[model samples]
Target: MRPETGMSATGFPALVLFDLDGTLLDSAPDFVATIDVLRAQRGEAPIAADQLRPHVSRGARAMLAAAFPRLDQAAREALVPPFLAIYREQLARHGAPFEGVEALLAAIEGSGSRWGIVTNKPEALARALLPLLGWQARCAVLVGGDTLALRKPDPLPLLHAAQALGVAPGDCAYVGDDERDIIAARAAGMPSVVALWGYRPEHDDPATWQGDALVASAHALIDPAAWPRPR
Candidate 1:
């Protein structure tokens, strides 16, 4: 199951599934912009840029909650659609692949391997961001949160992506920054890699999560020579 020399994953991941927002792309700039819009609408003071960056990978609802924790439950629900709408307009406006991600995907593709996305973001937004990043045609598959009745941590979407890519669960690997990402991949019977570079709350510890491997940096994942091998 070893990948050929140039692939990102050392073992040929029959399908390499990635979590979009934090695993590959740095999406905080645009996410922060949307937060600013929400803040303005609520007549609230703006949040610090540094304060919001770490939560970008967590998703829109999380960012909203962080910015407006004082809002009641009904008000929180009311703010969601508008927050999402604002984010939609700016999905890829300032996003960029984290360092080495483009090269990693290139190495995988160059080695005749396939890669795709399995994200908790809704389908429409995920689809829209793909073209902006020029990955719409290059990616082998995309399974968003609402693509099916369930999302990550449930395993259905990951299973669907593997199926679509003609890969078996045993041969695939999922990479993400959060604990749920690890849980979803494991539940789907695939190995998981904890991406340490992604957003985490101050108190969170990615190492304690159950992942087959822990990638401390994006460049580390791109380097096949440094990968974990069988004992």
Candidate 2:
């Protein structure tokens, strides 16, 4: 069955939250480029972007694994810092908001609702990336993976974001691309939407994530009617 569509029992959501990497930002290009740079340093040919795209949501380590399949777990873990360092240098050089994101943000603002980000990305990186997109001042709240002792799939980050926005969890809806995003929203007592356009491995399935709704693209989010309603 389709999830309920509007405000929850608490009220219409005062704030809408998004996950950074795969959901709001199309950051895979920059991520893949960074991995290619690493490969070049080792005299290895660059891997295809599509090969590493799905692992972007899973983080740097995953992308590294995809790029260097022969590396042992310890060797892969060792590349995380270098990967992030290179990524930081080229964070938004190729990154851009997903199609229709600007209009969606404008619609949210015009409707008198606040919007923010809750991402598993490190706080420093998240902070650094926002300004590159000129969203540093516009976002109402931002909760990074390091913002608290807990992260997505644990619910604390989502709950913390709602509290910081001065809105009840029931009055917020989170949009993300990962299963952990839905699990966290559910545990926080908030509704969630899965962004189908975001990163997903061939074996991954959004349908089984149990989000309140599934949106095909950012453009769909511009319409208030497309949001998940209260059950």
Candidate 3:
């Protein structure tokens, strides 16, 4: 902690932006429930949650790809509409924030820093999650994948959030679980922290993502000094 600032040495970043699925909320159980229903309709047994969890961060398409490797492209594409319909019903039914997330969020706010979400989840779906996650009024901003012309890996969402908050892009710190998350943050001129506690396949290497900081859990993120300084 820095005595004069009464904060971490660098203080918390002015804005702390997080990705949805793998970073802040552990919504995989809901996704798993959605996908398993589709699997059941085809007389297929529900796929293992372990098999589907890591890929959830990549979104529905990736989850489908992992679940139905036996299905060709078109068949899986056809499952999307039904998949989403089922997902809407299952939202937050069995999902909640990852352990330690609430405390971490409180810590960020306690430091007088604003935090928000910038996620590739669709706007309606993401908005639906706010109350379920108890973040309906706490977040300063929420930018979903469809909120902008483009989403993660495009930098637009992150930049848009910063602009909406009247913060310079460099004053924000982005946290996420995917390579695309780090890419978007970089393009938006914000330093990024890799959520190692989030999802990824065994073969995917986040070390190659080149983020400014990497943390093991939401608990680790509670420490103000863990955040990177503005660029």
Candidate 1 global CA lDDT score: 0.81
- Model 1: worst 10 consecutive residues (lDDT sum): 1-10
Return the candidate ranking by lDDT, descending.
3, 2, 1
RMSD of each: 3.3, 4.4, 3.7
Reference-based lDDT, each prediction: 0.81, 0.87, 0.88
Rank the candidate models, highest TM-score first: 3, 2, 1
- Runs of candidate 3 with Cα error greater than 4 angstroms are 1-10
lDDT of 2 by residue, 1-231 (tens): 222234533333567999999999999989978998999998999889899999999887789889999999999899889998999998999989999898888888777788899999999999998888999889999999989999998999998887875777877899999999999999998889999999989999899999999999999887777887633
Task: Report how far residue 115 has shifted in candidate 3, in Å.
Answer: 0.8
Provide the TM-score for each candidate, comma-separated: 0.91, 0.94, 0.94
Q: Estimate the lDDT of model 2.
A: 0.87
Superposed model 1: Cα runs more than 4 Å off: 1-11, 225-231
Q: For candidate 3, write residues 126-210 as lDDT tens digits.
A: 9998998789999999999888889889999998898888788888899999999999999999999999989999998988999
TM-score of 1: 0.91
Could you tell me the C-alpha RMSD of candidate 2 in Å?
4.4
